[model samples]
Target chain A: MKWESVSDFFAMGGYGLYVWGSYLVAVLCVIGEIIAIRIRRRTLYKHLGLRKRSILRGEK
Target chain B: MTINWFKYASPASFYFLAGRMIPYFSIAAIIFLIVGLYIAFFSAPTDFQQGEAYRIIFIHVPAAWMSMFLYVVMAFWAGIGLAFNTRLSSMVASAIAPTGAMFTFLALWTGAWWGKPMWGTWWVWDARLTSELILFFLYIGFMSLQAAIDDPRRADKAGAIIALVGVVNIPIIYFSVQWWNTLHQGASVSLIQSPKMATAMLSGMLIMALAVWMYSIVMILIRARLIILERERHTAWVSELKEGVLE
Candidate 1:
């Protein structure tokens, strides 16, 4: 709303790259961390499943 | 009335509690960030001196604060764990390191980007910047030392020592600008003094800081749950949880 147009907004009044660049790094790191943490949880569940399956097979 | 403080100390209970708590924190983080960035980019007026470059401080300052704050929290938990031999305490310290490191990296990276335009240099050996970099290394050293050790107990103890020893660096990072003649600007907002910036800018930065805090809690809780599971994998409760025998 502060900018006259969309271009002005992205330009950040001549500081577009610096402002957005810092935010981009933050966004990427956050997204990457979320994915990483979720993946770790998924991997844990998968390992549990494998163990359960192995135990069942051995009992049979 | 007596409070059973140790009730949640067990990993199994803490795991479920963390799972339930994470959604609330994550949602709060999302809300705060959206509002904060909107105010930062749209509502906050451009600075008289710095034009738009000052906007980077929303992310940079908060990240920098979190980097130092989290380290202290991590060290506190690590120290407590080392003294009392509390499993959850050490697990918490371990869980905090990655997020702490991430914020530290963000602080440095964003500081570089912000500096390039304003200071006309992408990097500097300014006391503040150098001390912050050392804090980053401290985080790395804590994590690496833990990973190198095979035994979790030993790893936690070793990591705790480093974390405790590294607390000295945080005050250094904070006072570096004051302690030494540095290129980095001193604090814009301080508890002891009136804020130097406008209302809108101050609010946006504070909101962003809150968002960062919420995000950290969510991440730390998630990672802590995972650490709990991995370390307690051999326990009956973990096996039962895996088998869906204990819901």
Candidate 2:
């Protein structure tokens, strides 16, 4: 809204790269945490299932 | 109003409660992030002093605040576990460490980026910066110490001791600017005094701070649920959870 055009907005008055760089890294780290938690849940569940199946097989 | 907190304190109850909380917190985080950034980047006026470059404060301040705040919250949980021997309390402490560490890393990294332009240096060995760096090291040390120990109970005890001890550094980090002539600026926002920044800037930072707070809550709850599942796997409740998942 402050700029004449979209390019001017993206340029951020010549500090564009620094401004965008900081935000990009910040957002990626936020998303990365979510992904990491999901992976941990998946891995832990898979391991739990495997361990239980092995124990059941041994008992059979 | 009746509050049934005990029902939520157990791991089994907390897992379901946390699961219910995730969607609400996650959605709120997304909404706040969108609104905060919109106000920060577009609506917030450029500073007459620092120009557009000053916009970095939108991210840097919130990240730095979260870094300090999360460390304290983590320590609080660790202390609760230490004092009460509550199983869920320790799991909550464990869940917070990694997210706390991540925010600290972001604060340092973004601080350097802001510094390179403002201070004409990427980093300095000043009091505030140095103490913040020490805070980062404390987070790492807490995590590494817990992971090193094989027994979960022992690991929780060890990490709690370090977290409680490291709390002395937090006050040092907060008061470092006032205690010493540091290159870093004093806090613009404080309870005892009026904010030094513009209203729009202050509002943007506050919204972003809330957004980050919500984000941290979601992260901790998710991780804490997983920790509960892994630790309680041998219990019947966990088996039911696993069956629910498999089904």
Candidate 3:
């Protein structure tokens, strides 16, 4: 509602680049952190799974 | 009829509780982010002087606040772990590090973005800016110190000392603009004074701050759960969990 047109919204009164740049960095940081957590969790589970299997094999 | 306050002091119970709570926090974070962004971009009027450039404050202020708040929480848990020797407390302290560092980095990044146009420069060594940069380094130092140690107990104690010592910087960062002349402006939204921003703008910023709060809780909980598993791999409960749950 602040802008008359779509381009005007993106243009951000000619301060578009700075405003959007700050937001873009924020998005990247959030995504990067989530991805890092996922990778760490996966690696951990895989390691634990392997250890469980090895222990079972020894028992058998 | 009284709830057991110390029941969740154990990592095993906390892990399951965190797992169950993540979905709710994640939902709240997502919802708040959507509403906050909508208000920030559409509902809030442009500033008379700075125009759209002032919009950077939406994220910048929130990130900066979180950076400071998370450090205090991290240090609190670290201290509790040191004093009481609680494993969950230590795990929580360690889990908060990377996210706190991320927010600190975001604050600096967004601050630079805001400064480039408004101040005509990307960087300054003003008291506020310099102190914030030091806070960032403190987070990095805590993480690196903990990572350097092989034993978890020693790492937690070492990190706690650094975190507690670094607490002196938070007040400095908060009052830096007042204590000395600086390029960075004084706080617009303070507990002691009425906000200088428009109602809609303040609401949007506050909502975004809540969204960030929920997001941080989700991240820290997830990270703490992972830490619990990593440290308790030899425990019977972890083995049972591994056998019962693929996730």
- Count of residue pairs whose backbone atoms collide, per candidate: 0, 0, 0
- Candidate lDDT scores, in order, read 0.91, 0.86, 0.91
Full candidate order by TM-score, most accurate first: 1, 3, 2
TM-score of 2: 0.93
TM-score of candidate 2 chain A against the true chain A: 0.74
Model 1 DockQ (Cα-based): 0.38
Give the docking tier of candidate 3: acceptable
Q: Which stretches of candidate 2 lie above 4 Å from their native place?
A: A50-60, B1-4, B245-247
Ranking by DockQ: 1, 3, 2
Q: Which stretches of candidate 1 lie over 4 Å from their true place?
A: A50-60
For candidate 1, lDDT tens digit of each residue in B9-96?
8877788788778889999999999999999998999999999999998999999999999999999999999999999999999999
Give the alpha carbon lDDT tens digit for every residue of B132-227 in model 2: 999999999999999999988899999999999999999999999999999999997999998888899999999999999999999998898889
Model 3: residue A50 alpha-carbon error in angstroms = 5.8
What TM-score would candidate 3 get against the native?
0.95
Candidate 2 clashes between residue pairs 3 or more apart in a chain or in different chains: none
lDDT of 2 by residue, A1-60 (tens): 787899988888888877888888988998888798878866985878654422211111
Query: What is model 3's native contact fraction?
Result: 0.58
